[model samples]
Target: MRKLYVIGIGAGDPDQVTMQAVKAMRRAEAFFVIGKGDQKRELVEVRTAILAEHVEGPARVIEIADPPRDRAPADYTEVVRDWHERRAELLEAAFDQVEGTGAILVWGDPALYDSTLRMVEHVLARGRSAFDYEVIPGVTSVAALAARHRMVLHRIGEPVHVTTGRRLREEGLGEGSTVVMLDGDCSFTEVPGDDVRIWWGAYLGMPDETLIEGPLREVEKEIVTRRAELRAAKGWIMDIYLLRAAEVRHAES
Candidate 1:
């Protein structure tokens, strides 16, 4: 039987990695990092930096190219399912080759809208399981964004709704809830500017970080411009934000 630990390396910064995550990495026999093509090579590089800084045991780091998603059809859900299946297959093969503790470094906390947990579940569903899998949580980008902006994501008694950029664009911002994790797409423009305030941060916890906070209508253009500039400069960016209605804050007070 083999043991596997799925550790969250947090968003961008190596210092954001939890001590438990580091302990897991140091104990693992092999570390597996996912590479999402060249555009996101920094993702793998960040994980490598953490390993180099913390891992003390004799562990081998392995980098695997993530399978391509069929995005041409634009069926997001279907494409993601296919991609997860392919990833699970690759992970299973890697596990078979390595004995002792195997580790997979995940971005941000595993439980917070991350798919690594789901992929691990898929591996377990195969019923050929011989590994005791564990998940180590880390600081989420949402937390980092909130802290960087010095804003409370949710007001007292008001719910905070964490959603993706697509949902924000499609359904618009929800009433009395704070929306976090808008991955690109400038979805903030969909909200009625008069009603909401946006605290947006790109590359949170990194040196190239950019943060903009103001009424959505006022800062929408600024956020868009800055995001575009940062992305173009670095070839990539990972951003998250919190959108809260002005009324929600006043009501809580």
Candidate 2:
């Protein structure tokens, strides 16, 4: 049976790739990379950089275009499920043409909000079982962000909540510790600036990365403009941030 190695190549910088992930890339017979259309070509470029830098053996790199998600709002869950099925079909077709150990380089850690693992599971459930798979963990952007800001993600006895920007906007910031990811818009504005402190980082682990922290009300505008400018210049951006209620610190004191 062919082996499938799903390696997390970290968020952006090539150096962030774990030694184990690098070994897997070199050992694999084939590498399958996901291309997110023309707009997000940088995603594939990052993966290619890792291959060029790490893979030394006779491994072939194949590019597979990711299927666009259906955005029409007719039952969000169903739309996502259907989209995953389509993606699985494309992956299966690519797998059919390749043999030996196949590898995929995932952005950030596969365990942290990444869909590559779920897609692999979908492939297995489709009754096309011919390979054994393993996931190699990578350094997550959240960890990098926190390190850059020099802040602990959670208090010793407090709960830490991980959520997306959309939920942060719709549901508002939760009371306990919270970390937000995949937030394109300035969702931090949704929370009352007076009551929270934010530690934010963008393009983390990359050379041009930026970090900003302070009471939200004081730095919110600056972060918004800086993020917009950075995104416009790079054509893409990945960011993560932490928000804590002011009361939490007061209670600890």
Candidate 3:
């Protein structure tokens, strides 16, 4: 039976790649890359740089064109389910090509907001392939954001909620701190309330990294404008933000 390694390469910074992740990469015969396409070609370049910097010796890199999906659909869950199925099919084909060891390097920890693991499970459930696999964790953008901001995720004893932008917009802010990811719209602006404090970061761990922290209303416009500028200039942006009620900060103080 063949083997597969799903390794987290960290959010953006190459140094965030752990020694464990390095070991996993060295073990693989071919690294399966999900092509991010031209607009985000810099993303692909970053991945290649990681391979070049750590994986020493010539390594085979297999590029898999990512399947398209509906970014916005009435049934978000069903659309995503279909997209995962399509991804599973492509991965299954790639896994079949590697005779021994193969891998897929994921950004952030596989457990958090990443679908690579689900796609791998889907391939196995399809009953067409059988391969033992392992997951090697890496630093997440959430951690990167916290470290860059030099602050903890939440006030002592309070729970922190991590969610997507769409969910944040729909559900509003919950108790404690709310960390939002995958928000195409600076949903932070929609979070409501001048009392909410926000700490936001984009291109985390990379050279273009940006950070903004202030009362939600005070900096929401700055975040939106900066985010737009970054996106327009670079053609893409990856960001995450943490929001806390003003009273919570006072309590911590």
Candidate 4:
């Protein structure tokens, strides 16, 4: 049976690639790339640069076109489920083509917002492919954000809440620090509070990396404008932010 390695390639910086991830990459006979199309071509290049820098031996790269997903859906979970099912089918086909160790390089960590691991499980659940798989973790964007900002995720002994921008908008702020990801809409703007401080970063770990930190009310508009300009210039953007309500932090302390 062929083996598959799901390796995390860090958030955006090529240097963030771990030695363990490099070892896994070297073992793979072919690297399975899930293409995100032309908009995210920079990401594709980052993956390629990792392989070029770490994998010294001959390796084949197989590109798998990602299944289209609904950008906005009334039933988000259902749309995602359908997209995953379609993705799993494509992965099954790609896996069937390889005979030796295969790999899928995931952005950030596979355990985070990424769905590659789930798709891999879906492929196996179909009973069509037989292969053992392993996950090599990488530094997540959240960690990169903290490191870049020189701040902790949460106050002493408090739980850190990691969530999507949509969820943050719906659920409002929790008791502890909240880290928001996949928020294309700048959901932080919807979070109501004058005392909240936001540490926001985009294209983290890469050359175009940008960071903004200030009272949410003061910097929210700047973030929105900057994000728009960045996206318009690059055609795509991947950003994450940590929103800390000063009142909550003071109360918890």
TM-score of each: 0.92, 0.92, 0.97, 0.96
* Model 2 lDDT per residue over 86-177, tens place: 87877877887777889988989999987888888889899876789999999898888877887788877778889988789888877578
What range of 10 consecutive residues in model 1 has the weakest lDDT sum? 244-253
Candidate 4: worst 10 consecutive residues by lDDT?
A: 244-253
lDDT of 4 by residue, 1-253 (tens): 7899999999888999999999999999999999989998888888888898998865688889998988899999999999999999999998888998999999999999999999999999999889999999999999999999999898887889999999998999877899999998899989987899999999999999999999999999999999999999999999999998875324565
Per-candidate Cα RMSD to the true structure, in Å, reads 2.5, 2.1, 2.1, 1.8
Report model 2's TM-score to 2 decimal places: 0.92
Off by over 4 Å in 3: 248-253
lDDT of 4 at 250: 42
Residue 113, candidate 4: Cα error in Å is 0.7
How well is each residue in 11-89 modelled by candidate 3, as lDDT tens digits?
Answer: 9999999999999999889999898788888887888899999887887988888888888899999999999999999
Off by over 4 Å in 4: 247-253
How many backbone clashes can be found in candidate 1?
Answer: 0
TM-score of 1: 0.92
Query: Which residue ranges in model 2 land beyond 4 Å of their true spot?
Result: 57-59, 71-74, 249-253
Error of 1 at 224 (Å): 0.8
Error (Å) of candidate 4 at residue 203 is 0.4
